[model samples]
Target: MHELGIMTGVMESVETAARDAGATRVLEVRLTVGEMTEAIPDALEFAFEALSEQNELFDGAKLLITMVKPHSCCLACGAEFDHDRFHMFCPQCDSFALELLAGRELHIDSIEVDLPDD
Candidate 1:
């Protein structure tokens, strides 16, 4: 799945940042994934496990994912609500005019690394 590709990119970035910070090992990675992105959590976890095994820096690293529900604001009634990807209409006014306030986000919130003792 595309999770592999996604994890590959994430690992590359984490590696670079960890190295730049003089980290001896990566301890954890925290990610925020939106439901609208359609990225499967199980698949993402599997990908992370597979990729991490290939890198020494990621050994025993933990992957923490925060799932974000799709949130939107209605342009018609100024109503804000949470909804699934399929139903995007505003509940208050039943209007299709909506602006997404959150979700569709794929971001690395933070990384925990073991830095060299200097």
Candidate 2:
């Protein structure tokens, strides 16, 4: 699954951030995933667990995932609506022309870290 690669990138970024911030350890990570992303939360969790074991920075760190629903705007009627992955049409105008406003995002929202005692 691509989740492994994605989680790898996430860990790298987190570690880099923690290092740059002079943090002793990473406590938690929150990721925002859109409906359009094929990455599964469970799969990502599995990857994170497997990959984070060797790194003390992420040891015992909690992984939190937030899922976002897809929203689109109808080009014809200029109407915005929430829709599922299977549909990409306007509800009001029933037109196939649609502009995706959301549901294609995959990024780290926030990271909790334990700073070194100054």
Candidate 3:
């Protein structure tokens, strides 16, 4: 599964961000995953739980995922339609030059952290 690699990237990014922010511990990480990404949330969680070992920032952190649906707009006909992972073609006019309006995104929405005492 590519989830492991995705998780590693996420962890590394958040870890660096947390450290830079002077956070002693990371409490939670929120992510917005696109529907077209076809990522298994449970499997990703499992990988995250397994991979985050002895990481002071992520040892007991929580992972939250929000799924987004794929949307597309036809460049030829200027029609908008819902895009599916299995089919990348435009539904309205069967155009191959459809522009993706949504989905296929994997990024961090936000993070919760415990700041050190001042």
* C-alpha TM-score for every candidate: 0.95, 0.95, 0.88
Top-scoring candidate (lDDT): 1
Better of 2 and 3 by TM-score: 2
- The CA lDDT of each predicted structure is 0.94, 0.93, 0.87
Candidate 1 TM-score, true structure as reference: 0.95
Residue-level lDDT tens digits of model 1 in 1-118: 9889988999999999999999999999999999998999999999999998999999999999999999999999999999998999999999999999899999999999998888
Q: What ranges in model 1 sit over 4 Å off?
A: none
Provide the lowest-lDDT 10-residue window in model 1: 1-10
Model 2 residue 61 distance off true place after TM-score fit, in angstroms: 0.3
The total of clashing pairs for model 1 equals 0
Colliding residue pairs in candidate 3: none
List candidate 2 segments past 4 Å from native. Answer: none
Candidate 2: residue pairs that collide: none
Candidate 2 yields a Cα-based lDDT of 0.93
Instruction: Write the residue-wise lDDT of candidate 2 on 13-61 in tens digits.
Output: 9999999999999999999999888778899999999988989989999
Per candidate, the number of residue pairs that clash is 0, 0, 0
